[model samples]
Target: MSYEKRPDGRNFDELRPIEAKVGVIKNAVGSASFKIGKTWALAAVYGPRELHPKFLQDPAKGRLRCNYNMMPFSGTGDRIRPGGNRRAKEISMVTEKSLMPVLDLKNYPNTVVDVFIELPQTDAGSRCAGICAASMALADAGFVMKDLVSAVAVGRVDDKIVVDLDYQEEAYEDGPVADIPIAMLPRTKEVTLLQMDGEISKEQMAEALELAKKSVDEIYEFQKKALKEKYTGEQNE
Candidate 1:
């Protein structure tokens, strides 16, 4: 028996509801939290300060490091062990690449800009959510950026392409499948990060790209609202 799809009958181009909150952690230099459906991510940015070790320093530019980790209870069944793993490392590396283009690294010189993303829920498209949260945190940190980066994921399941896969959809797929995660600078329409997993035909890839672009636009609006609220509170003081 086949399971019924979700309500709203959203088309391939539609995105799940998104919510963003800024300054969630007062102690961090900057912090932001966001959720897309059941998937949630929180990001914190720290420092344009001195590098940790002599060997790690870069004379030409500041270093930007990212750490992406999933909470033990993020998934439904088994829990993940805390610390670096292959998947976590890959996500962190991708996140670092995504933000490097937007940041004004030269301005910071030998300093380091560190970003940490924590996923407290497991669902499809969490990587994209991580990127979105990290970008917002960086913005809250008052770092100069060319434009805000927004991200989204698109995938195919049950012969129907979809935007923002949920946890179950990602797990039990059959036949050819595709998952594309993208990070783009919304204002400039520049792509800083792109990753695809599984196999997809060229036509399907094109369709997914279109859907991701639309999703990113929606996410950008949500992020802007959260940032405005954070700044407004500061102004009122």
Candidate 2:
């Protein structure tokens, strides 16, 4: 298959090497560790427990909240400060939203399911990775859901559409690189999360969506495989 040339010497349609595993944390209900090239993200799921402050609890459905963070040494740059900043807060919100639609919250009732995501390594598609890892962790946690959400980043570079851009590739252009992150429920083909940093023509947007869908398909497979590996082992014992 013909592919667009990329600065990282990868085909435009190709994703960086990805490896993921679930249940890395023994005590946590669910946990996952994932890496895309050098960038990595870890996620852990806790509770479906009582909601703090009580008033925030919804009696009819459970709550899903995400806390996304970047470790100071995650980036190649100098030691970064730890704690929430504007960027971290925004990403946490989006990441939470991306995974919300797929959860069958009503059954949970008055409890909150907290998903904590950390980017131990910074890269262009960290948010997408966070979503993917969180989903895996949730599945490992044994929640009822329509489907595990799959995510990927789509970018326009040198007039070519690319999947899974790295840090340098994401910073390639000044204008809208069309840095878009999308999350989808593969079975229903429903979009759970979408964010665009730059604008593109209608045609490019269509191409981007198509590209994202295909990329998500691959991601979903990995997620499923990771979950199966975890539960299958437990069943054997």
Candidate 3:
């Protein structure tokens, strides 16, 4: 059977409903929660503090480190293993890279900024949600950033090209499935991270990227609004 409509009823170019908020973790220097459909990621930022182990400190600029982890029962598919794993490490690396372009760490030279992302629930798109949450947390930390980073997964499920593939779409077995996760800077529209799993033609890849570009705008707005709400609440108080 051909995949004509999304299992969730979203249009090919539509994204799942999103929610975001900053300063969700009071103890952290910065924190945020980002939710897209059933996936939820919480990020907390700390440091720009002096790096430990003098040999590892960068003289030219600060380093960004990201830690991503999914709770044991977070996924809809199967139980995630507790503690760090290869997948968590890989996503942590990519999340750091994706948020680096917009950060101005030069002033904090010889220091390190750490962002930790934890997914308590997921229905797919966990990495993208982690990136989105981390980006917001960084901004909430009052870091000098050129623009917010936004991300989403766009892919082909069966014969249909769709935006924000959920767990069901990712598991579709009838035909080919390609999952592409992309992160971009809002102001420049520059792609910071792009990764693809499965197979896609060059043309389909191009189209998927364009769709990701358009879709991230919405994610960016939610990020901005969340940051704004934090300050707005402070002012009202």
TM-score of each: 0.92, 0.93, 0.96
Question: Residues 112-143, candidate 2, lDDT per residue (tens digit)?
Answer: 99999988897778998999999999988989
Candidate 1 lDDT by residue in tens digits, 1-237: 333463446565678788899888788899999899888999999898899887898989899999999999997778988889999999999999998899888877788988989999967788889999999999999998888899988877656678887666667445555677889988776888888877777787787777777778888999999999876775233
Top-down lDDT ranking = 3, 2, 1
> How many clashes does the backbone of model 2 have?
0
lDDT of 3 by residue, 113-229 (tens): 989999999998999999999989998899998899999999998777789999999988989999999999877789998999999988888889889989999888988888898
> What TM-score number comes out for model 1?
0.92
Worst 10 residues of 3 by lDDT: 228-237
Cα RMSD of predicted structure 2: 2.9
lDDT of each: 0.84, 0.86, 0.91
Sequence-dependent TM-score of model 2: 0.93
Error of 3 at 161 (Å): 1.1
Per-residue lDDT, model 2, residue 30, is 91
Compared with the true structure, the alpha-carbon lDDT of candidate 1 equals: 0.84
Best of the two (1, 3) by lDDT: 3
Clashing pairs in 1: none
In candidate 3, how many Å is residue 154 off?
Answer: 0.4
